[model samples]
Target: MKCPKCGKWSLMKFYICKNCGYKIDIKFEELVKRLTSENDDIFVSGMRDACSYTHSNKFYGVYAMEEAIKRKAKSENIDFYEPGFTYRSGIEYAEARSELLSLARKKGFLADVHLTQELISIWLAMYTHLDFNDLAEEIIEISKGLDEIHNFQLLYNQMHDTAVLNNNDVQRE
Candidate 1:
C-alpha cells in the first residue's frame, strides 16, 4: 500500500509509512475492492497496493492477484472461473498479464524463487515480449542503480545463476 501522506509504497504488514511515518489504517478488503472495481483509476490504486503487498509476502498477495486476473477476465468478457478458461488476447488482458508477470518476477527475486534454467528462460522470454513499462509504476517498483536490487538476492549463487541463465537464453535464441 502507498503512504497516503508521502505517496510512497510500503508493505501492507506495516502500519506506519517508512518514508513519512504516516499512520496507515486501510483495510485489505478495501484494497481488493478497488482492485476489482470497474473504475480504471481505482484499479490502478489497487494494483499499487497489491504490488507493494506482494513485494514483501505472497500469503494474502495471492488473493489480490486472483482479483486482478478475474478483473482482467471480466474486462475481456470471459468467465475466469469457467472450467479450463485459461488466457485471452485483449488489450486489458495483456496489460494485466504483464503486470502480474512483473509482480511474479519481483516476488521470485525477493523470495529466492528457484527454477531450472529452462523455466527461467521461458519467463524471460515472456517478459521480453510484453511491455515492462505497462504497469511498472504501479506494479514492479524497481529501484534502478541501487544496491537494493543486488542485495535482495537470497543466495549469492542465485544472482550469478540468473545472470548466466539470461546469457544462455540470449545465446540460445
Candidate 2:
C-alpha cells in the first residue's frame, strides 16, 4: 500500500511511513468528510484530484493545497480576475488571498479547526513543506537578484544607444 503522509509507494507493513515517519490514521479522512460543506461528489472529486496530483508529482509544491483552493473556487463558482494570478503575481497575492479566505470563511471553512483538520488529511494523503517560510524567504532573496539583472539590462541598452549616437555624430562631422 502507498503511504499517505510521505506519498511513498512502500509495502504497508505498519501504520506509519518508513520513509518520512508519518503516521496513518482514519481521523484525517473523517475530518475531511465532516468539514466539507459541498456535495459528497465535489469533496470526493477534490480529494481524488488531490491524491492523483500528489501521487503523480510525488508530493511536490503544495500538493493537496492547490486542490483545496480549486475546490473552493469550484464550489463557489467564482471566477478569478485571472486564474492562479495570485501565485505568480506578488503585488496582488495578499489581496487575492484575503478575498479567497473571506470566501472560504463564508462557505463554512473554519481555519483554526475545520480547514486545519481538512488540511491534515490533505497533508497525510499528500505532503507540504516543512520549511515553507524558509522557501518563501529564499524566493524573495532570489527576486532581489532579478531586480539587479533588470537594472543591468537597462543600463546596457543605454550604453549601446549612447555608443550608436556617438558613431552617428562622427559620421556627421
Q: Which candidate gets the maximum lDDT versus the true structure?
A: 1
> Candidate 1 regions off by >4 Å?
1-26, 68-173
Candidate 2, residues 113-153, lDDT tens digits: the string is: 23332222222222235533343344335443332222222
CA-lDDT, candidates in order: 0.42, 0.35
Using all chains and alpha carbons, the TM-scores for the candidates as numbered come to 0.30, 0.23
Q: Give the Å shift of residue 120 in candidate 2.
A: 22
- Tens-digit per-residue lDDT, 149-171, candidate 1: 22221122222333443444422
* lDDT computed for candidate 1: 0.42
Candidate 2 stretches with Cα past 4 Å from truth are 30-173
Consecutive 10-residue window with the lowest summed lDDT within model 1: 76-85
Error of 1 at 101 (Å): 17
| Per-residue error (Å), model 2, residue 68 | 5.7
